[model samples]
Target chain A: MTAASDAPQVRIDGLQYCNWSREIFREMRQGGLTAVHATVGYHEGFRETVRHLVDWRTRFRDNEDLILLARDSGDIERARATNRTAIFLGLQNPMPIEDDIGLIEMLFDLGIRFMQLTYNNQSLLGCGWMEKEDSGVTRMGREAIAEMNRLGMIIDLSHAGERTALEAISLSQRPVVISHANPRWLCDSNRNVSRTVLQALRQQQGLLGLSLYPLHLPNGSDTTLRQFGEMAAEAAQIMGAEHLGIGSDLCQGQPDSVVRWMREGRWTRQAQAAASFPPQPSWFGSNLDFPKVSEGLRSAGFGEAETSFVLGAAWHRFITVSLPSAV
Target chain B: MTAASDAPQVRIDGLQYCNWSREIFREMRQGGLTAVHATVGYHEGFRETVRHLVDWRTRFRDNEDLILLARDSGDIERARATNRTAIFLGLQNPMPIEDDIGLIEMLFDLGIRFMQLTYNNQSLLGCGWMEKEDSGVTRMGREAIAEMNRLGMIIDLSHAGERTALEAISLSQRPVVISHANPRWLCDSNRNVSRTVLQALRQQQGLLGLSLYPLHLPNGSDTTLRQFGEMAAEAAQIMGAEHLGIGSDLCQGQPDSVVRWMREGRWTRQAQAAASFPPQPSWFGSNLDFPKVSEGLRSAGFGEAETSFVLGAAWHRFITVSLPSAV
Candidate 1:
């Protein structure tokens, strides 16, 4: 391992939803991760999602040496001081809240600091990226967003469609984030954000964590680390260095069946036969390989301070602003 | 409004926990209710509680003129040929399937015909009626009481105590019903079950659904119904009367606060300060007063066909043999 002084100053991955285990925790330590915004729920409803929280509590207890639950930016700082990776809970879908608006406060109390309004279809809140007609945020979505803003929870729009994403940007009183998505200018997938959204995100002082999932990469799974880093540099030129950071969207150690569940949930009766786990790019396979992207950013003509900011400090700054002061 | 000849023959009041609309489905077609089980859930888990089914997709649309989601006894012969009142869904506590159990075939497919393990305290599977030391259910109770035996899903042990109820009558190979409790002779409380549990119910294939909701009313709630019907004389007899019936744990047109939550759901942070509703014993205050309970049993005492059995037959017959042939 490199000397402690050589490590990036504040290495936080803006998002990850790995099949977490002690091995992964060790890899986060190896990767010099200060913290991770970990996805806790997608299509899971409230009670089932509480079970997930219980599972995470067990994990936190079992792995106390390597990780701690991060409730605030100060927790992240404490993790860095203790040489542990802080895991902040996030949700990729609003299904956990179900139809009840009161549950927003309940979930926030349970340590969920971030939540997306939709996943890949029409939700009670908003439309997902895959929905054909984006009606923007629904009536319930507006109430939920207002509650989230009051509680200072980050509104994520990573899986939201064009109009919904844009509307959320305009509606949210607090700055929001596209926690894991590339610019559509770089990767033409529906999962990536358009240039217009990026401009609005920058205007609103929102953060954009560039994704490294294969499908969102320009050259898919064959994309080189250097090429990926250069794309980050180009995105920084459009959205500025202060808003750019890495959110690998990593799916390390997950089986193929889990991928199907993540996509299909219980929304449909039939299995999503066509959907399967894609091959991860060789340049960045897991938390252990996070340093490769940091190194690539350096090699892509970024200065020392700018590289550190893009690597993690940008996300740290965003979180410090996003999370509630009291919570 | 109909003549006595045109009135529905069967009348059952298995249970009810409605946030009752005052309209009352035309007073259950003026009190000729063929069957009524009519209770939803208590301390239910969020997603799996089948609120969608309770929302009554079919009842709200196609079958509004006839029934209310009874999955038994041919929907009470199609609500006595469209006069309408067949509402059979029972749940006393939330501990039936727990989380690990696979939604139970009877619950998911057949719509939860009946479930009662506990209502007063901690129950991994058993122990109710406020035991000082809840030893919890025996190993068999842990195995699959939620799975429901082949005959039908009627496992009511109304406010049972620890050891007696948790033993579950030697793990119950077929089906069992305590339908309602008036058993101070067994344990001495509003929540006791008498030696009849060991006797008539086991030997004669009888059911028991006797409750007036004024806490085991021998004298409470004015006690007139007891004398008017010779309830003591009939109950002293063997359980040959097809297991007796009338679980009138009724609270109709209750205030919204009464239904704010059945138990203090996890949604609330504070304990419910005023935990009890007002007294409700003005001679069957709702569902058009259920006059059959008063008039029929009185005439039956003069050597009719045991009007208690008539009052109970539809429910007993429904539960004795089977749940719905299909959902």
Candidate 2:
């Protein structure tokens, strides 16, 4: 591996939804992560979102290595430089914004950098990827986009509808992202963004997080890290490595309840479809961890430069562009 | 006042988002409600939903006064007959369903009777009041509706989009309802179901709960039982007493955190606007206990039949049709 490929990767679990419990904090610490974009929204709502922040503050009041709040690119750099795990608050949907576009700025101020247009279904913005009609951005959705743009919030389209994601990519002046998703060419999972969606994100200088969830990959069964790397390579072929990063939708040590919460349709409190899939989801996740990516790069026989970009260099670009150059 | 009005009235807080704390249980017992449809889905996704049932079982397990797991109409009568507060398991949003339809029956088997189509924003079924576009029901949403109908779960449109709610009411075979809503004519709050939406529910033989939230009514500053009664009475005039009931949205002693969760929007754990509202939502609640509706009826000059119908009869019909005959 080139020096760049081996450059101490600042691993970011692009998408992870865990409880505000001590156990989860401990698990994140164990994941060998330098930074994690932890999701703070879902059934609990926005207040719970803030409470999560407070919880981190309480947990790491003095011991900053456990978890620290990341508000800008500088924060992420500091965490990487200091060997700390930085938690960048993110929302899967704009539901917390409710009907008020003003809230976009409010939450942006609260250190939430990555925010998708919607969760699994719909929110104040528009339909999610799962929505059948794939409703594009609405009038209010436009205003929300503008607010998010002005606030410099990374427009994450991981769980957003195709038309809406494209519309958002086109509308925003800055780079956006599919924070954690696989390619639809591989598997037609709702968690996978369509090629068209990827194209739009690419055109606008956005990013795509190659998801570790096998369900989102070409094969939901027994996928190895090599396949995960191949998928990232495929995306790199399209969006290029600069816009491709590791956004592992990782969930380690979360209770069965947490997994169940995600499978439930978007924005549902009691929304569940019954337990058909296995309780544990991280089997494929194990293959997609940061270290595993190194071995996968070998399987792909990726060029040194490309492998280097696939590692942390790609994410480094995203973080740099997302925050102000001044910082 | 008529003798019927004076007769010990059976009251229910209808819907409450409380922690089921010992104090909360005592508050319910003291509130004089024969039962309360305590929300189990919002904070408790799947396991926690069960946890609430278990918690209630333990809290009021042997008390005999607090009936745990009353999922249908029968629980109310059994609770009323047994002098216990019937605890109904309801979901504020269908998020627990996640992506599976079969889970609907599983949840039904668990005694989760009433389910809101969407939370403050969106779900698999449709867009919520906060969603920018009323894209009506998506494909999965229709399936969810059909599943709920097949399982005999009561469909709640309280937080649904105007078009979606109207469409759901039309699509539903069983009567649907806005478990908590005010006439849009009463107050212009988005929380208030529009006249057209209410009419659709009325046409479908659905019920409308008269929420005690003063902002939903025109009489916010001078709010009183009389004004509240008039709100229901007006609903009765438009949709008849059979379609009228009390949701109360009676959040008493509920901390600011809980309210923040409610208004924070459906897509997240909570909204950024959490805590932007009042701490104690006790201003509008059943102060005289559950049977306070008896006083509300008498003070409003409602006759024996009207009082009976509004106070408990409306709910009785709703439960009878939705649940088993026992309620």
Candidate 3:
């Protein structure tokens, strides 16, 4: 019980955040989320790249009451000290960094803790999880790994292609993160990481976050938060407790525009990449209004301890070990 | 004929763009734009705020056979040098700089020429075009003005609120760009500029770009491209030739995800801000791409020279003088 208040329920990896608005924070609070592994970069668009970290730092520095900017192990203690949730700034697509090696460290300097290699399609690092053909991580991908390792930035392979992700797992000196993903073996979805990859993720000492996209589930739109948690539980069964987290990818408070942008129908460039991947079904609504994930975990018969671990503790350990206090 | 080949035509004021692949370049080509002032930022969500610029510079350097990155007035020559369209990298949201005034120069060092104050809602500078109530410019906004002025980055007031924009124009030594905006007096759109402000813009020697958003027209989606052009022509009449430029505001070829992310409705905190703006009646597809701006100008009986000037020459003049050469 004492520990339950101290850390995130599960790791809660791969929270697909867009902008850090007060509205989003309100949604998080109302949804009953204390913390999230936030994606700072884009599934599409610009200006949000490195800016995500800056805003978090500003929020952390300016308002120490509700949010904590976690850079070191101490920040977690500080989070518990203030009852503020921790935000691990994640780059969903390396396209934010473009091709610069130096920026990896600079971003870490600005408090970017987690970095996803790709999302949905191709980036300089490698093909995305959704790509029809994942040729594996590219030469740039290898370099990115070295740069990330040096910068104390965690290499998150959440939205990465299978071959590329495998190569990245093998290449990365530090443990990586599949921050927001599902098990392909349980119910095959290109967006989900394969069981073999999940196994590799576990073996590599990395973490696998079960995502909450309806398309990734067997029943999809009808899938409840409990089913969503089950997907994580299945992956946990395969990857083990230490390596599993749940990424809500909760865009609940986001507008239809945000959903449209993700859907790739006709709203944004996501449309351009649709040819390379299967179109996501326009599911029920934006991120299941927050607490549903916890309800799902509870309904899934997850204990408070398990839910706590699943909710946030998983990310706490993952980030602590993945991104050291060196920065 | 010479002017037609050399002038900056259709000076697009605003489009929330990110680090695009070659596919975007092809789209621009298909759009038939002779010159484009595009943006680089995380308005959606990607990574590397400044690295986005470096990536494009490299792409332009390698693909000089096709694209050109314009910095200062010279790159326009270079674009003309290789018969490629000149690209002025604009920062849509100052979020890319992350409280660093110096980074403005660093980005300018990498070929950033234009900078917008904010995106949709608010930033350090003040309220965005979409904020219900404007906060005017902030103290930091003052510092930004000096930095941008010192660096010769033209102040873009497209997404800025009325008070902040007027303040920005007044505070700056040079003329700012209200790039890709319509006249609010004409259609009462949030994204559109007011007619009273237009008078002030002329007095301040600022450039006013006629934006193209169907929602900002008097007619709904039923409005034709010709109607959109007429609005521009009307703004041009008010602002005069030297102060006029073609700001296409084309969201075409963008992703559905981008559209989703921007609109604040149903799922988002700020989605329905523009709901009252009234979209124009549906057109017969889009007979108006960027090239249509030129053709529209011609059909309106604008002389070939003036048409060319409206397309590119006006933008060239605005940018050439707006930015400092040595700073």
Pick by TM-score: which candidate is best?
A: 1
Best of the candidates, DockQ: 1
Candidate 2 residue A106 Cα shift, in angstroms, is 1.7
Candidate order by decreasing lDDT: 1, 2, 3
How close is every model to the real structure, measured as TM-score? Answer: 0.57, 0.47, 0.48
Better of 1 and 2 by DockQ: 1
- Each candidate: chain B TM-score: 0.33, 0.87, 0.83
Task: Tell me each candidate's RMSD, in Å, in order.
Answer: 16.3, 21.3, 18.0
Clashes of each: 1, 37, 75
**Candidate 2: where is the Cα deviation over 4 Å?**
A1-7, A19-32, A265-288, A325-327, B1-327
Q: After superposition, how far is residue A317 of candidate 3 from its true place, in Å?
A: 50
Order of candidate numbers by TM-score, starting with the best: 1, 3, 2
Supply DockQ values for each candidate. 0.04, 0.01, 0.02
Judge candidate 1 at residue A304 and give its lDDT: 80
Q: Which digits, one per residue and each the tens of the lDDT, describe model 3 over residues B1-327?
A: 797555544333334243355755665655544467776653522235545644665677676666676666666655654556667777777776667665565566556678888877788777787778887888888898888887788888887888888888788887888877778877877778888778888888888777656665656566566766676677778787667876655554555555555554233555453343333234422213456666666666667767656766777777677655532
Q: Each model's interface RMSD (Å)?
A: 13.2, 19.4, 8.1
- For A233-275, candidate 3 gives per-residue lDDT tens digits of 6776777666667675655545655555554633255344323
Q: List the residue pairs that clash in candidate 1.
A: B207-B243
lDDT at residue A20 of model 3 (Cα atoms): 59
Candidate 2 chain B worst ten-residue window by lDDT: B274-283
lDDT digits (tens) for residues A1-327 of candidate 2 = 896446566566666654445555555556556677777776455445545544555566555656677777677667767766777788877766666565565456555787778777766677777677877888888887887877788788887777788788888888887878888887777668777888888888887877765467676656666776677777777888767777766655566666676668344567566433332323434312455565676677677666656655677678777765322
Worst 10 residues of 1 chain B by lDDT: B101-110
